[model samples]
Target: MESDLLIPLIWTVVFGILLTLGVRKFTKKQPTNKRWVRPKSTDEINKSQDE
Candidate 1:
């Protein structure tokens, strides 16, 4: 093939592979053993104390 065309073709394929792999990895489900908890904020704590 030609010289200039080869470089851009290689870059496109490499980046395309990376993008697909990243999307697949992100979409894969992960196992969870426990539920998530949210902590109370400082405002809530102050209001509770003042009441």
Candidate 2:
């Protein structure tokens, strides 16, 4: 009975730690030119239509 509780408690702590680490990794700063980031230029729409 005690072992069952212990296993889940340990797993919960480990999972919480892992989640915090993963969140930190993703939230950290990176180069602004990364593909997922949108460009700041408002002229992009105009330029695209002219193409």
Candidate 3:
């Protein structure tokens, strides 16, 4: 009887982990920009502001 209960409990844990990993794998945030660009400087910020 204990072995039967243990088997279901182990399966439940395994299923829960698999579900969490699947959800995370599918629902992950995708990067909008793939390019690695340099950061804007203060001068660039000021120029845009003046424009």
Candidate 4:
């Protein structure tokens, strides 16, 4: 009984930590400028594809 509860509690903590780290890793901005890349609108994408 205790073992069952303990196993899940441990797993929850571990998964929570991993999830937090993953979110932080992706959310961490590296810095960028228009020279590297820029966002394109849907219309631009459609126009480019048509050409």
Candidate 5:
């Protein structure tokens, strides 16, 4: 019946959210700096542009 399908679908969604939160909690707390680079200040920008 539709109700049976709905119940399983709801449970699946709940389980997915719980799993995502659990995995996030288990991972490291450090910020990911590898993908980011420091931005140049105005002086650095002007110097680069002057070169």
Candidate 6:
């Protein structure tokens, strides 16, 4: 009875740690200026110029 509960409790802790690390690794920000890559079309540029 105690072994059954202990097994799941240990697995839960291991899974929680893995989940935390996986999210930290996968959701990390890349070093880049994202705004500079998006070029405006001529029409869009002209519209902004008119404002």
Best-matching candidate per lDDT:
1
The Cα error of candidate 6 at residue 4, in Å, is: 1.5
Write down the TM-score of every candidate: 0.55, 0.52, 0.58, 0.54, 0.53, 0.51
Task: Candidate 5: list runs displaced more than 4 Å.
Answer: 31-51
Give candidate 1 misplaced runs (Cα > 4 Å): 31-51
Q: Best TM-score goes to which candidate?
A: 3
- Which is the winner by TM-score between candidate 3 and candidate 6? 3
**lDDT tens digits by residue: candidate 4, 1-51:** 699899999999999999999999999998766485678989999999999
For 1-51, candidate 2 gives per-residue lDDT tens digits of 699899999999999999999999999987676477676686987888899
lDDT value for model 1: 0.96
Q: Quantify all predictions' global Cα lDDT against the true fold.
A: 0.96, 0.89, 0.95, 0.93, 0.91, 0.93
Model 3 TM-score is 0.58
Q: In candidate 4, which residue pairs get closer than 3 Å at backbone N, Cα or C atoms, i.e. clash?
A: none
Clashing pairs in 6: none
- Report the C-alpha displacement of residue 36, candidate 1, in angstroms: 27
* Per-residue alpha-carbon lDDT of candidate 3 for residues 1-51, written as tens digits (9 for 90 to 100): 699799999999999999999999999998787798899999999999999
In model 4, the runs with Cα more than 4 Å from the true position are: 31-51
> Candidate 5, residues 1-51: lDDT per residue as tens digits?
699799999999999999999999999598766877788899999999999
Q: Which stretches of candidate 6 lie over 4 Å from their true place?
A: 31-51
Candidate 6: deviation at residue 40, Å?
A: 41
Give me the runs in candidate 2 sitting further than 4 Å from their true place. 31-51
Rank candidates by TM-score, best first: 3, 1, 4, 5, 2, 6
